[model samples]
Target: MNKVFKYTSIALLGVTLAGCSTVPLTGRKQLSLVSDSQIEQQAAASYKEFLGSSKTKVITGTSNAALVKKVGNNIAAAVNRYLSSQGLANQYNFNWEFNLIQSDEVNAWCMPGGKVAVYSGILPITLNETGLATVMGHEIAHAIAKHSAEQMSNQMLLQTGGQIVGAVTADQSMAVRSGVNLLYGVGGQIGMLKYSRSNESEADRLGLIFMAMAGYNPGEAVKFWERMSNGKASGTPEFLSTHPSDARRISDIQKLIPEAQKYYKK
Candidate 1:
């Protein structure tokens, strides 16, 4: 049994090392057990299902919808230009599409391969073209950074660790196994939350640069986030939340403006 545990630990360590990857621009190391093609395949299926479903009302043939596409395309083009310049263009093969959904959710999201959706509710908060670009750039950054794949990889690792724990504890009492599993589950959730916050921060940073490169003022990001913070309900603390505190995010964006401005063309 000791030999089995030793071998398993060594194997797991090797896999962890092999899976380590650096996030673009941020240079943050992340686990990437899944391939980009796999993520894109899943995203394509999910995006189709979402758009086809009755739960979502996609708005089209309107000025607002056009604006969403315009801003999304600008950011996407800028990101592609950067990737090409870095000789990483082959890393992504995006079939970009942007849609506006009629909802009051005050949110937007982008999937792998540049599938994007913006909620009408968020437009009021965005308030202008620059603000809209701020939101789109951030969401697009999440995809460009491959955050979804990183998250999936983290979950895979956590599950594998749990299975290893269970195997090693096979001789223990059922109560002991259950207790250990419970503790592991709690720890996994906390770890996931931390990763999510980190992803959001990275997205914010990358988005600022992308918007600037796309000819949008990076300074608008601070204003957009401030509006979001005002609308947020008083709930979980920053440590427990899956996003940075409003003040912290605003301050960070302010500091990043100069760096992003370097990429600005106008």
Candidate 2:
């Protein structure tokens, strides 16, 4: 058993090293054992199902909705342009879609293939177009950075038995597979919130640049996060939480502003 464990550990380390990839902008190395197509296919289907079943109405033809779409598209475009210039265009093949869902969740997220949803509850906190851009940019940065896939890959590594079961059950019924995927995806989102401080910080930094490239002021990110921090509900302490403290996050953003400003058009 000891010998077997040693071999398994070595094998896993080899696999991890073989699958490592650098995150754009941040230059951080990350595990990416799963293919982008695989993750995106799952995300697309899951996102569709979520919209279909949830107490959700897609907001359109309204000023707020238009702003959301505009900001999302701008950020997506800027990221695409940057990727293309870096010769990493093939790394991103997103069927980008942005929507505003009528919910009071104080949250927004972007799935693997650029499926973005913004909750109505967050709008009050966002306050204006730049604030909206800050949130959207950060969320979009998560997708572009492939944070979800990285998390899933990490889970597969840490949960070898569960990964084996998942592979074996891949041929199960659509209903069963969808159910599992949906549950896992939701759990992954929560897990993302609870174990992604470095990912969040990287997103914040990249988000500042993306928003600036999209023509929004990067400085607004500091103000937006301050509002979020001030309005935060009672929860875990910042040190123990998955996110950096608001003050720390704001200070980091301030430091990145000079670099991000170079991308600002206006």
Candidate 3:
């Protein structure tokens, strides 16, 4: 390799080490090459646009809609309480919002900044409040763990050839914005990287703990995933497609329930 490129690679490796942040509860180090506040702002705009767009039908004033908000808030409160207890609350500046959207796509997601949406189609699979809590908690875990930003940072690092110290400080790129939109199935619908399997596992573990802290039985998550596994549909639900529900995932969640139970109380 040329001297310039070789030195640049070494510099990038140093930055990579210095730029790592730990995922709470999981203690896994992840890249932190981007700004959380910037990503949250972009996500907020995309979420607002998604809500305001003509094709979107946001359900309101119904029992199900209320339930969605309730579960989201409960999980958010649990997460916040846990973070605050750890003196890590200041690290997470989440302005939580939850809405039930009218779609038969069987999907739900939580964007960075605690913006959450639940598709009406998933309700049948969720069945009840605990089930909804399972879903919301899992999605919220993604935000809490900063999975989206981590993915974006890794992408930026790749695209900029490890010059992210400068790139991340610049205005958010269209690529980043597209990623935020894609998380919600909003714009372009391309090039967004899915969370890694380890990230998925972290979400499952933290989700169960969050749900348990919110007074839901973590064991319910197993049954919820079972229903998701058994459901018949015309095609793969967006939830399962992104989430990868399989025997191993279900078994891993089962193994995590005991850990989650420590936070549980009647």
Candidate 4:
């Protein structure tokens, strides 16, 4: 009886190990070490902490602010529809919120579980509603793609044994927190917050599709990217500095235009 139990446990472990897989849309194979529920709990907690630390300015009745929210919400809805059609709707189970920050840094990001912030500083670069949609779509796409979770999970796999990827008991979560600080580029943290070039390209392509599906003209992406490239050459935009170089990003986006155009609503 003891021998039978040992062999059965070994077989179960083998099956679980073999089942690690990749996500759709990005096609980057994942270690699948962490369960979705576990990650969601962690992400939700982290997101709340982030919000608490942030000094938020609620945008009220302003044209620019309203436009951004309108476009952002539209993109979010489109992303939900896309996920639902793919039979993956249950993955995002949080209340999504979008807000504009009255700041002078051309920056934006979506936290895990769909907390999005767009800075007023980026408005000039966006130029119009379509351009704003392009930026918001791209940022929101990162959340939809589960890039943050993948990034965190990859760090865990690297630190812990990949064979026991999903086995981070509560005792090990403290060590994982140290890695998170480094991953997020907190000053004095050991690791660099370097995003791979492939991830950047994927975001650009997927972002383009999301914007188009949300009723913005896909061709606007090309022009918007061109303006972005020019802005970088003239002087680096704060947002573009950490991103892939303008030439590389623009070329990649141009290549993705036809596919994005297919999803264009008008």
Stretches of candidate 4 exceeding 4 Å from the true structure? 1-21, 35-54, 161-195, 231-242
Reference-based TM-score, model 1: 0.93
Write down the worst ten-residue block by lDDT for model 4.
184-193
Residue 178 in candidate 3 has what lDDT?
48
lDDT of 4 by residue, 144-245 (tens): 766766666556544433223233322446667455334333431222134434556677888999998889987788787787667645365423344667
The true-versus-predicted C-alpha distance at residue 40 of model 4, in Å, is 4.1
Q: Scored by CA lDDT, what does every candidate get?
A: 0.89, 0.84, 0.83, 0.70
How much lDDT does candidate 3 score?
0.83
**lDDT tens digits, residues 151-182, model 2?**
88877765663353355457777776566556
List candidate 2 segments past 4 Å from native.
1-9, 161-195, 231-235
Output the better candidate (2/3) by lDDT. Answer: 2
Model 4 local distance difference test score: 0.70
Off by over 4 Å in 1: 1-11, 174-176, 231-233
TM-score of each: 0.93, 0.82, 0.81, 0.73
lDDT of 1 by residue, 131-192 (tens): 99999999999999999999999899888877887887788888877887787779888999
What does candidate 3's lDDT look like per residue over 1-266, in tens digits?
23334555576687688788999998889999888999999999999999999999999999999999988988899899999999999999999999999999988999999999999999999999999999999999999999998887766655554353234324657775445333324211222324466678889999999999999999989999988888544365434354445676889999999999999975
- The numbered model that scores best in TM-score is 1
Evaluated at residue 91, the lDDT of candidate 3 is: 94
Instruction: Name every residue pair that clashes in candidate 2.
Output: none
Best by lDDT: 1
